[model samples]
Target: MITQNSINQLTYEIIGAAIEVHKILGKGLLESVYHKCMIEELKIRKINFKSEFKVPINYKGVDLDFDFKCDLFIEDLVIVELKAVNEILPIHDAQLLTYMKLLSVPKGLILNFHSNNIFREGQKTLVNEHFKNIPK
Candidate 1:
């Protein structure tokens, strides 16, 4: 089982990658740029992840054909959504939450890489009931 510490470490790794992307691209680039760069960073780090992973939503007991594509699913335990907005918005969190529910993931990270100062303004790690229910 994935632990909280593992999730946090992965978040920090992704945050470091985001900071680097921000440093080179700076603010104002579209979210796609950040998403692409982060994928490269994850590759360089040899981290296991699936980009645009298709998450199947359950309708009743059967798995539906339609799916939600998450930006990044790390180690099959965490979900990541990338954004390059001027500021983090409420809908962003809601979107991640929805992804978590659909993906059956315990933790998710919402990364906004367009901030002038990334350390102070660019990231959020969200934990759901699945994560909380895990034994420490």
Candidate 2:
């Protein structure tokens, strides 16, 4: 049973992992480099995660072939998108939101690795409503 508190704790852990990765690798590297370093850090921290996991697509009840691939699926809990860019833009957040919707996930994270301060400028977390059709 995933809760907001659990999600928040996990988010902190993930951010810590990202900071460790940035500390080791510094900036100006490829996204893959950060991805790999983060994975290593997660391993050292005993965090369970999957990389490049398949996100199936159902089209009118038909499953599509390899529809979407998530960067990191952590404990089947959250989607982690690794970015090696100057800043994380709205499009990046939108992309993660789309992944959360399609995967029927409750939460996601967007982590950028090309920043001087990874914690301050690199992490963005999001959550989606379980029932998204409510009137606001």
Candidate 3:
């Protein structure tokens, strides 16, 4: 039953969890701190997620051994990338997009924990061709 509407709702819940973590920890913390808090928040909310999930690479019908890890892979649907930088750079977007492409995921999120507000300035959601093919 994965649809655009469902994905949107799931995204809302994920962002809410991040907001809760930011509200308590505030800014100026390390990315790992926020990462750990997010894990707890997701568990408390009963959201399914995998932390430090590995992204496999394949080339010419051969699987390559690599250690590309995504910060959070939620419900096998969304790829969540956590950051605690002063600002999100293009490279951050590229990184998340690349993960989404490699995994063939429909949606991805960049959650920056260093912003003033998680809901307002801290989150960026991106979608790719996979998303376009999903039912509405």
Q: What is the C-alpha lDDT of each candidate?
A: 0.84, 0.84, 0.97
lDDT of 1 by residue, 18-81 (tens): 7887888888888888888889988998888999988887789998887678899998888989
**Pick by lDDT: which candidate is best?**
3
Query: In terms of TM-score, how similar is model 1 to the real structure?
Result: 0.90
**Span of ten consecutive residues with least summed lDDT in model 3:** 1-10
Show pairs that collide, candidate 1: none
TM-score of 2: 0.89
Model 1's C-alpha root-mean-square deviation from the true structure amounts to 1.6
Q: Model 3: what TM-score?
A: 0.98
How many backbone collisions does model 3 have? 0
- Models sorted by lDDT, best on top: 3, 1, 2
Clashing residue pairs in candidate 2, if any? none
Which 10-residue window of candidate 2 scores lowest in summed lDDT? 127-136
What's model 1's overall lDDT? 0.84
Clashes of each: 0, 0, 0
TM-score for each model: 0.90, 0.89, 0.98
Backbone clash total for model 1 is 0
